[model samples]
Target: MGTGWKLYYTNDEYIDERSGRCPSTDEFMYYKRLDLCFNLNSPMTINFPVIKTFCSHMSAELIRIDSSDKQQFIEFITANETIERICIQGTDKIFPPNWTFDDGTLMTFFNEDEASAEPDGGKGNIEMYTGYKWHDISDVTLHPCLPICEII
Candidate 1:
């Protein structure tokens, strides 16, 4: 049989893994091996600036794609869950044509979808919708997206 996984909120509250019910509060799923936390809730969408603010309140930042096995992580998240076009922390506003994470880390890893034309020199920040693809959307646009926050 396959291994079973348990879900927990940031506050250490337990959630029924099979139930697929998210905690009412801002919550994250803790990955023991990676020691990472990720949050993806539906029916709540916020813009880049607002997402940044929320992360700040939690003392976290939008998920960064700097891991060595980034593609695997992306695939895992996309295949197992139904996340709205959530916002990660990469923007090309500072250095034109160069995208960087919110923590000032250079974005050297990318997993754009094969069918998508990303970073089209568009306005606003970047978003992760449809699996591993990155799309440039307006900062003011209210999408059915969530902010994937990470402590580390």
Candidate 2:
């Protein structure tokens, strides 16, 4: 493999001492590629503990994802049933509590009330929203999956 791509396999490049965030494009690309090596049933975080830890910190907030890397992530999670829910979290004060898709799509999850809503009458059903929704809040196990897919 080329040295230019070495950063992906090497964990040394993702360390962020100050914020503890793995906000690197190279690191994202590495994970995007790593998806090719493992099944969705496998735990992706185990392969990159730094990023896994960083993302776990923000599972509740809507995420701000890199536009360049979002598609691959969406495709991976949607395709792999083993891998459940992905969310974006950030510490920046300016960031919103909720997140929008890089392409400007709105993604959300349904609360118990919304999940049980009936068709047509259940306007709150999150799955009925224009974009994607998680199986439920508890299923949101994957965090920042897209951040690791950013193209360097």
TM-score of each: 0.69, 0.25
In order, what lDDT does every prediction score? 0.64, 0.31
Best by TM-score: 1
| Candidate 2 lDDT tens digits, 1-152 | 66666444546422322122324322222242322211122234322234334434532122333333444455545563443333332221222333334333453422223454312221121121113332222213333233222211
RMSD of each: 7.6, 11.7
Alpha-carbon deviation at 41 in model 1, angstroms = 3.5
lDDT of 1: 0.64
Candidate 1 lDDT, tens digit per residue, 1-152? 34797774453332212123322246666554455566654434657787777776766677786765654665576565566576767778777677777656678877665576776755747777775577877777756675667666
Q: After superposition, how far is residue 133 of candidate 2 from its true place, in Å?
A: 0.6
**Model 1 residue pairs with clashes:** none
